[model samples]
Target: MPVQRPFNFSAGPATLPEPVLQQVAAEMLDWGGSGMSVMEMSHRGKEFISIYEQAEADLRELLAVPANFRILFMQGGGLGENAIVPLNLSRGGKVDVAVTGSWSRKSAAEARRYADVQVVAEGSGRNIPGSANTWSLRSDAAYVHVCTNETIDGVEFHELPRIDNGVPLVIDCSSHLLSRPIDWSRVGLAFGGAQKNIGPAGLTLVFVRDDLLGHALDICPSAFNYKTVADNQSMFNTPPTFAIYVAGLVFQWVKQFTYAGLQGLAAMEQRNIDKAALLYTTLDASSLYENRVEADCRSRMNVPFYLKDDALNERFLAEAKAAGLLQLKGHKSVGGMRASIYNAMPLEGVQALVNFLKEFEARHG
Candidate 1:
């Protein structure tokens, strides 16, 4: 039996649902009597295809993705997709990138390798100023990239920007996928790594509108080309079979989840909202801790905060770990504490963290 671990809050490769882990463990040796573990099975085999198809189907149902969109289960984390997005879509044309935080900054840099990348908007603080109308978007831009949620900075775009230029809007939603409903009407393409809100580290979920396909530059790798992957059902190269299977199980789990008389992803999103609200409320009320993100743009998934006295950082982390809260240390760039309450983190977990925070402050204050 895998050891039961405490509540984990690592940013990526974070904690997964206990039930999903249990299911993966149970099926590790023999997947439904196929006489082979999913890991051992060939990606071309029917077993893996069924797993891929079901995962895609269930995710489509859960998110209400339009039929015109192709959900490609590819290999490559968010970092790899940074270049792949530009390679497939840029077509050597200009691309607009909104740099709200580290991820978008990296995306812009990677795209510059393939296209004339422009920083349509960049943020120095917690949020960006000016409206979409003021952005100097290029008419020849292939697609506009936006990091829907800045995990390190705790900035989130609660609403997608409206661009007057007829450019496809691409979103890097790795940290906040499935935490809320996406406005598919505004998004032409959205890519997310599975580790955050979906499943394991190797799998990447890319939703590309049908029209966006087949625009790959000649320099684009055949393996990373969206049109090629879609044509072959994401099996052009052996897909991440095991990760896709686990993600399918997670999608099933999400579809069955309930909250406040709502069910499915809507319920999961509402619960995420409530959980973030509770933690933010506690942090804001406390005198010793401060969350720097703007109230209007606070992230519902990643909450980064600082102690009033930086001297207590180590003590805060050590005590948090001892109290069954793990990985509360923030990213090194930000230098504080970050609590990533993904879809797997229950309300009870947040409540426990909140309680520990209050007790720790009272004792040390």
Candidate 2:
């Protein structure tokens, strides 16, 4: 029998699927009788090359990405891409940004160093702006950027904005990459740090439409240029070998997942929906705790809730840890408690959290 582990609710570097972890452990010593661990294989050798190709292929199929889009696995976490994105897509001209929360705000700030950034619309920090109709888009802007899911603030875009103008849409989907299906028709470029929903840190995934390539500014680093990386098939420099391999395993696990008769990504989406509903419903009904984000725009992946009494914060965390629920503290920027239920989190884990919430309130209230 497997030893029971605590249900982890960390925002990133979070819990992975148990089976994936087991598989990693079983293969850690020697991968497929090659007499070498995957970590020890040469990236240029056939062993690692096959792993990279299958990972790329499985990810494309899982997301249903179009043929016109090129999926490039590269380095630089989401923050690094904040600068790399502008360097490649900004063309040293004008760019438009919609500041919904912390992550998008950072993206806008970074782009300003490379191009003239226009704040198209701004959210109130608690909720998304009403609509795209109010945006002040620039006709000459290179691309319009948005963070689809704000991990810190617990806000998500259920429906993507429709840009009638010619500007392409660039999204930072770091926190909720594979929880559901993406409408590729509406996206021009989508990038995410693999730590949240995909895999571990140090690997960033970029899916760029073909037309957007080859536009890196003269100041763009040769290695960071999108076209060059894509042309070489993401091997311009040695890729993050271990992270990519683990992510490939995750993709395979997602493909085989099943829930409530649904399969694969559809099943994953339904499970996330169910988990969020259970937690939010409990919070809304309780007088001791509440989620501050607007109901309509609340993030399904990251749920931030606060106790009615501020004095209970420390006691609440201590009790939660003692109960085997870990990492429930919210970001310092927004104080409260956050429960991040990504694809890897099981439904039983959420149920356990809900039970603890009620039990904690009963003892304190």
Candidate 3:
């Protein structure tokens, strides 16, 4: 029998597939007969180049990204892209942002440093705009920004808002990048950090439309210039080779993932849907726990809940840790427990968590 690992619920720098971790461990010292660890290889070397190219191609295929979008592997996490985005795409013009939750609020604040940022649509701490038409987008705005999934607030946008104006849409999909299919028709740019669902930290993926490149402001660093990074295929500076390698393994793992007669990304999406539904159903039926986000806006990946009796918070987290469910602590800003069930978190893991939830609630309720 296979050994069971503790289920990690961290929001970022989160869990990866066990197979991917195994492959990384197996190849840590030497990769593919190159006699060199992936970490030791030069970014420009063919060994690493092949890894980079395959990672990009596999991600493109997995996400069904259009040919017009350029996938860039760069340093700095999602927050870096918050500034880098406005520098490249804002052009000092108006940027209309839909501030739905913590992450989008941060995105709006960051963009304000580089452009005239507007809160086009505002959400209560517990809810988000129901549709694209609800936003107050500007006709002349350079781009409209949204964070598809807010890890902190436990909210998500099932469908991206569409802008009939000429302006494009830029999204911070850091938390739920590969959990489901992205409707690319409504997105001009999408960015995410590898740590959440892809790979280790320090690698950020930026998918930008071809037309949006080459428009960086004069002050933008050459390394961060979207056109420059694209021109060099994400090697403007030394790319995160090890993270890319691990992410490529993840992509391969995702491709081979099978579930209920589904395959690849399709299977991953279905599994996620089922996992979220199971978890939410359990929470809904309980009197001891509550998830505050609106049913329609709740994130499938990040589920934040509270104990009816706040005094039980520490006891709950302690018992949860002893039960092998790690990182169940909530963000300090939001004092509650959060479980981030990202792509790599198997259904069995969620089931284990669900089992623990019922047991805990029964003992406490």
Per-prediction TM-score, please? 0.98, 0.99, 0.98
| True-structure lDDT of candidate 1 | 0.91
Tens-digit lDDT track for model 3 on 262-309? 999999989999999999999999999999999998898999999899
Q: How accurate is candidate 3 locally (lDDT)?
A: 0.92
At residue 237, give the lDDT of candidate 3.
Answer: 91
Model 1: per-residue lDDT, tens digit, 59-133?
999889999999999988899999999888998989998888888999999898999999988886488645677
lDDT of each: 0.91, 0.93, 0.92
The window of 10 residues in a row where model 3 has the poorest summed lDDT is: 128-137
Stretches off by above 4 angstroms in model 1 are 1-4
| 65 Cα displacement, candidate 2 (Å) | 0.4
Candidate that scores best on lDDT: 2
Local error of candidate 1 at residue 348 (angstroms)? 0.5
Report, for all candidates in order, the number of backbone clashes: 0, 0, 0
What residue pairs clash in candidate 1, if any at all? none
lDDT of 1 at 309: 94
Summed over model 2, clashes come to 0
Q: Which is the winner by lDDT between candidate 2 and candidate 3?
A: 2
